[model samples]
Target: MDAKTCLEKLKLIGVLSFATVDTQGNPQIRNISAIHYEPDGMYFFTARGKNFCRELLENEKVQIACFEACPAKVIVRQPPISTRT
Candidate 1:
């Protein structure tokens, strides 16, 4: 599928699973519904004080997963750029 199509499908799914590693190197996962998609990539929101935000700040790498129940398909992606400064 094309990028546009994939993005559309993700939007239809509404919520996506985001996985990240904490400072202790443990895996953390959360469901994120607030996202903004652009041609280049997508942006998701989490409170600055939240562990999810802290994990993202500490570790740039993240895995996003989307599941389509009807088709039984799973899409996983990792951002090419760092999310932290």
Candidate 2:
């Protein structure tokens, strides 16, 4: 599907489940129910500075996976903001 189609699907499904690799190369998967998807990318709300934010800071690269238990769209991008920074 194209970006627009993907976005529409995302909107219909607000929650997203994905994983992020920390500096240690450890895979951390999180189920994010609150996500704000923009044209550039997606955003998540957290405290001013949290470990998850630090995780994003440590590794700008991330994978956001969403699907209908079938075809999955794995999005790879650097979140604009990290919980720590």
Candidate 3:
């Protein structure tokens, strides 16, 4: 699906899964609702310090899996901005 369609589908559910690989190549999957989608890409909030945050900083390769009638996976890269400001 296109980014717009994919984003709309993801937003409809209001929740998504974020997966990352640690330095040792261990797969890390976690349920997340903090992801926001845009026409260009996705946006979200995270602290400057956190395992997930650190992981992303080290490796931008990540996945956004949203709960749907069927499973959907969206590969995400780059660090998400902190909305705390």
Candidate 4:
């Protein structure tokens, strides 16, 4: 599938499984619904005090997956983009 199609599917799915490694190098997974999609990439939100946020800030690497009825699983592996105002 193309990038556009994959993004559309993700948006439609809403919640996604975000996998990240903790400070101990242990795997962690959680369902996240706060997401925004762009043509180039996607964005997700997590509370600053949450383990998810800490993991992302510490590791920067993450894998996002979404499973639908047709089993269209999309695994995105990339470092989080930092934007400064």
Q: After superposition, how far is residue 14 of candidate 4 from its true place, in Å?
A: 2.2
- Residues 1-85, candidate 1: write the lDDT tens digits: 6667777777667789988888888888899988988876677777888998887776667887888766745465655454643
Candidate 3 accuracy as TM-score: 0.73
- Which candidate should be chosen as best, given TM-score against the real structure? 4
Could you say which candidate leads in lDDT? 4
TM for candidate 2 is 0.68
Cα lDDT tens digits for candidate 4, 1-85: 7768778788778689989998888999999988888987787667788888888887888888888777566777768678222
Residue 22 C-alpha lDDT in model 4: 88
Between the candidate structures 2 and 4, which one is better when assessed by TM-score?
A: 4
Rank the candidate models, highest TM-score first.
4, 1, 3, 2
RMSD per candidate (Å) reads 2.4, 3.1, 3.6, 2.2
Task: For model 1, give the RMSD to the true fold.
Answer: 2.4
Extract clashing residue pairs from model 1: none
Stretches of candidate 1 above 4 Å error? 1-5, 72-74, 80-85
Candidate 4 ranges with C-alpha deviation above 4 Å: 83-85
Error of 1 at 49 (Å): 1.0
For 1-85, candidate 2 gives per-residue lDDT tens digits of 5666676667767577767777688898877888887874556775546566667767667676776655666464445553433
Q: Which segments of model 3 are wrong by more than 4 Å? A: 69-85
Task: Name the candidate, 1 or 3, with the larger TM-score value.
Answer: 1
Better of 1 and 2 by TM-score: 1
> How many clashes (backbone atoms < 3 Å, residues ≥3 apart in a chain or on different chains) does model 3 have?
0
Error (Å) of candidate 4 at residue 59 is: 0.6
